[model samples]
Target: MATPPALVFSDLDGTLLDHHSYGHAPAAPALAALRARGIPLILASSKTAAEIAVLHAELGLGTAPAIVENGAGLWQPGEGSSQDASDYRRIRAALQALPAALRRPFTGFGDLGEKGIAIATGLPPEAARAAARRQHSEPGLWTGDDAGLLAFAAALAPQGITARRGGRFLTLSLGGTKAQMMAQVARRYGAPLTVALGDAPNDAEMIEAADLGVIVRNDHGTPLPPLDGEASGRVLRTALPGPAGWNAAILDFLKQLDRRGGARTDG
Candidate 1:
């Protein structure tokens, strides 16, 4: 059998899941349909590993891999609750092995509990300021206290680090983009097709990289700026916004696929 795309990397907040501050529900039938299809719905978000775990458990996706801290860390599922001990040790060792000048700062709830970690950098003044603005406006929405948060973002900036916003918090990374992470996952799973959906600036990378990029609308039914107007053919900007918008976009892609004999792949 030809390998179907094993992964659908989704931005949690404002894309697959709504931002209700907390206690948000995935759009029922849409989420159910994806789950039913046996497609691995990967939660790619700016959320900390712990925060993502809450959603993962709620969604009943046990042991799925997550691209956390804006791609600074790839948290693979292990035999038990947390990352495999050997894998965890490998990541730690790899991180420590880097020169002090090259290493980026990071933290997580797993550092606190089974939740996970949130890492940050202390470079790039503009990015650090941008992230600080977002995190300050919404406290407790992320895993850090004020000091940790600033220090977290700051740690990444100097090493050419930056943060990408999604759902509720800004994700700090040494220099990773959502598109790069999505591609990595696709290569790992041998996914022939990747249908990605997201809203907000942080999602631009994946939106640009996917075989089909679906831009979800906001609550007022306004499509965001085209990811790249010069390359308008690459994106399907929707008239609908929010969860309802995503529902429409995905359904449309499936319909288009069916009409074309499903030859659409390899963006």
Candidate 2:
């Protein structure tokens, strides 16, 4: 398939940057190449707007808004249209259904006065301790491990929130899938051929929805779960990890799109 001059929608953290609690370097040359070709890189991540803002500055991106809190809201550069009002309403409704004890310790973007929002799962002290000890490694990143996080999620069963782990944090949402966020943004941009890159389950929806889905290899050099093997002849897998992986994925897909007349470069 040919790649077009397209909006390359990517996730932050593990997919594009190491963010080893210290923010690693990106493939600056490759990224510069993309920019030189007039491709706009859009960040879609679980990071809060505040966090994403810092990253945007670091990445040298102007003000491209990101999907914060796992697609709960969309942020655009110089635009604050409040696209996810319904998603937030649903999130609040879901939170209201939970037992008071289960909801007390949580906070969100609204609570922080538009800085960013999040809903906490007030885990039991001991369980929280275990979660902190085993599941969570990066402070201010995760609540705990898969098992521990899942347990915490279970406590919110009544409220219907799911805990998904991303590069720096665990997020709760009222079933806000990344695909939904991607589609919404794509629509605004006339739904151009999308190239989505991510490295975890939370990104599954967006990856599948993209014209091309590229899953970055994990820390162990393992690829994220492949698309349904039988029907996904279009899916691509990358051997590269971190920034290198992102560069590879974008360059390769753009090549494919160019070859097939699916995309074009400005220069």
| C-alpha lDDT of all candidate models, in order | 0.55, 0.60
lDDT of 1 at 56: 76
Which residues of candidate 1, in runs, are more than 4 Å off? Answer: 21-26, 79-156, 219-224, 229-231, 260-267
The TM-score of predicted model 2 comes to: 0.68
Question: What tens digits encode model 1's per-residue C-alpha lDDT throughout 81-130?
Answer: 34324433433344355455444333322232222112233214443332
lDDT of 2 at 4: 27
- List, residue by residue over 142-211, the lDDT tens digit for candidate 2: 4234565555568755665566656445566664567887887777666367778888777777888888
Clashes of each: 21, 23
Deviation in Å, model 2, residue 233 alpha carbon: 3.6
Overall local distance difference test of candidate 1: 0.55
TM-score of each: 0.62, 0.68
Q: List ranges where model 2 is wrong by over 4 Å.
A: 1-4, 21-24, 79-160, 167-169, 220-223, 229-231, 261-267
How far is 92's C-alpha from truth in model 2 (Å)? Answer: 10
